[model samples]
Target: MASNNRQNSKMTDDGANVTSTPSHDTRQASSSIHVNNLSYDATEEQLYSSFCVCGDIKSVRIITDRLTGNSRGFAFVEFKNTTAVSDAIKLDGMRINGRPVKITVAQPRNSINDNRVVQNREEYQRNTPSRTRVVHCKKSQYDVYIGRPEYWGNPFVIGKDGDRSDVIRKYRAWIMKKPEMLERAKTELRGKVLACWCKPEACHGDVLAEIADND
Candidate 1:
């Protein structure tokens, strides 16, 4: 119930605690809204064009399927202030890509799969105005980035199948193995920001945050 605890404390409807991230507290969540019933064909540009009339939008996040990389029929839209939230809500029945969408205030994530990175690093997104806003992996176009999926351990098989988490898992499974690599990671991440990447959306950086976050 403490402030940090509440900000950091997220739980599922069943009451299980899971890793939550930057989407809410990381940005002006008060001005953000959740969008549902999206057409898979909807583009960020289309959503922005639709909602821009309400007010200046901070960002628009369209949820996507990680493995297959397709739209998941939902997204988050953030404006410069809460007033736009009200205006945006009025457009709930508006269509994008020919689908009438449903709109509502955004909610905090309380599931493992709904993961993201923490922003403790100083230089990660330092110059960005909305640096607190988390980013999307594919959207950001990064070859290797930190995020929530890394923390949740979603069966990353390697060479045989998976790769990222698979390598991280094997790191622990063997460190029982390390380059000192584990120690180096800890040292490098010290005194930095936490999950500043794609919020509410899971990322591999989540695992990095957890690892360096611990003793």
Candidate 2:
């Protein structure tokens, strides 16, 4: 059995050290619980079934090795309600398949990059001439920017000169593999016009527009 339980700690906005959460998650600490000292053979399904008895569960993610894809003897479970988090924490220090488990509220990850963004914006503002102006727009309302296909300007497009068919095929395949990107794109493009930097006939932006229109 793998005896070592892998743990990760990160700094939060409040200047406190805490367990790291997923980068894309925006849930509060009360909604997530960390479980450690898990049996090496413990499965996510088993963890779900065990925790679901306390309340509704949203997700169960067992941390694993990036190289070997083996369990790392710890996991993070998110519940649908704060009450469920409280209930789940009650099981801390309890035996699971003969191994005692450690449970606690998962800590929020810090947004250090936000500070850098602010600093860069300030520097740009200070250096800019009065003749230049900046326009701020919501991300969804902003125009899409695609570069020349030969110059690799459009990351979503593949192949030389960026064939439209190839772009669409590649994009569809990419979204299929990354369902989160598809979901986010669907959400961001809602009620917005889709326009790309390149000509409509030459760019793959039409493929994305088609997706948004269908939605």
Model 1 spans > 4 angstroms off? 1-29, 108-215
lDDT of 2 by residue, 110-148 (tens): 568678888998897578543211122233344433334
What tens digits encode model 1's per-residue C-alpha lDDT throughout 1-215?
44464335678999999876456545434688888999988999999999999999999999974433558799999888888888898998998999999999885454543443334334444643431222454454333334435532323344664465565565455432333544554566544444434445444445545445444
Q: Model 2: clashing residue pairs?
A: none
Mark the regions of model 2 whose C-alpha exceeds 4 Å error after superposition. Answer: 1-29, 111-215
Superposed on all Cα atoms, the candidates' RMSDs to the truth, in angstroms, are 21.5, 19.0
The candidate 1 region of ten consecutive residues with least summed lDDT is 128-137
Per-candidate TM vs. native? 0.39, 0.39
